[model samples]
Target: MNILITGSTGMVGKNLINHNNAKEYSISGPSSKEINLLDKSKILDWLAKNPTDLIIHCAGLVGGIQANINNQSGFLFNNLQMGINLIDAAYKSGIRNFINLGSSCIYPKNISNEIDESMLLSGKLEETNEGYAIAKISVAKYCQFLSEKGFNYKTIIPCNIYGKYDDFSETGSHMIPGVIARMHKAKINNDNYIEIWGDGKARREFMYAEDLADAIWFCVKNIKQIPKFINVGIGEDFSIKDYYQTISEIVGFKGEFKFNRTKPVGMKRKLICSKIINQLGWMPKFSLNKGISYTYNYYTKEIQN
Candidate 1:
């Protein structure tokens, strides 16, 4: 099988390429410079010229809570265009096997317990990432609609993912990377204390990038065996304060933490139920402590350079 993976330079895409040990498949990961996702003409042209059998659409306009809140329209328009164009072009080019990467944020905001796949679009979405959530929902709906026409496509909704190669910008990175960068910077700068958003009570589920990569590989090989949409995660969660303490310890940050009561904490408890994917014999390997340690080391050595 000849597979094409978009967002090759991203955390998940990079890990996917690295963890793929199968000897039978040929994988190609195109950089943004080589294939601009927003340009539908370029996507179609590339697909026509390059014969690909499978496509793992990982490219999108992704960012953290602050970034999402700041660039709501950009998140919506850019992500929507990318998914719509890539999948449609692939389908037109005779590519049947497709795996679309989605976020758990598509679940309703009022979720107080374990989130199920059936609960999608059941209610309102988190205000902080409503635009991005809407974009993901559109992609899933598109794939679901196309499946009725004999398209072998499905969407995988993964919980909060973090690891090496993640965006660490203060304004653009997700929760884990943002916390790592801030604590690392504060430790080096010898700051007395660091401030965190919200009261540190909300809980979240996290999956390592390498684990997600492995799961994607599993799905591609077993695409025909899986359902139209599935959730891939560790099936566990922790509080914000626990994350702060853990990250601080991993980054060697001794500074005190100050919780900002005014800042927004998107969801009270956003935990996904990975029972379906688990039943398929796929599971995450990295524990939170181990993943944080490995990611922090990577950040200090590679990203800090």
Candidate 2:
């Protein structure tokens, strides 16, 4: 099979391309320079020349809460445009199999229970990341609408992901990567403390990027049996403080954490239930400690140096 994966340079895309099973298929991961997802013509032209059998749409403008709040318009417009342009172009190119990656942010905020795939758009999204969430929701719905029309396009909503190739910049990193970066720096500099956003009470579910890649490959092999929209996650969550503490232990940061209550924490909790994917004989293999340790190793070797 011939596969085309977007966001090839990003963490998830890189993991997907590097998966052990990826050797079984011919994979083409186009950088934006090769196929700009925001431009329909470019995507169509690339598809025409490439003749792909499956497209895994993983490209997007994603960031942490502060970044999301600061650039709502960019997040909304860029993500929405990329999704629409790619899916439409794929359809036009007669490509039927597509895997649209969605986020846990698409679920409603402040829910006291684990978010299932059915609860998408059930209520208001978290204010901090609402714009990005809205764009993701729109694109997932577009995939569903097309699926109803006899297309094999499916959306896989994964929880927060962090691993190799993740953005660890101060301004753009997600919770795990940001925390890993900060803790590692603190450990290296012998800093006494590090600042955490909010009260460090917000709960989040994160899966290893490589684990998500495994799930995607499983879905690719069994695309016909996959649901229109499915949730892929570790089926558990931890407090922000738990993540910080875990990373601190891995990075050997024996320091105090100061929580700034004034900062915004997007959702009180955002744990997705992976019952469907689990029942379908797919589950994440990495534990939080193991995943974070691997990610920290990657950071020190790849990003820090």
Q: Estimate each model's TM-score.
A: 0.97, 0.98
Candidate 2 local lDDT, 164-192, one digit each (tens) = 88999999998899888878878889999
State, as a TM-score between 0 and 1, how close model 2 is to the true structure: 0.98
Tens digits of per-residue lDDT for model 1, 208-280: 8999988988898789888888999999999999999999988889989999999998999999999998999
What are the Cα lDDT values of the candidates? 0.91, 0.91
Evaluated at residue 297, the lDDT of candidate 1 is 92
In TM-score terms, candidate 1 sits at 0.97
Ten contiguous residues minimizing lDDT sum, candidate 1: 16-25
- Superposing all C-alpha atoms, what RMSD in Å does each candidate have to the true structure? 1.1, 0.9
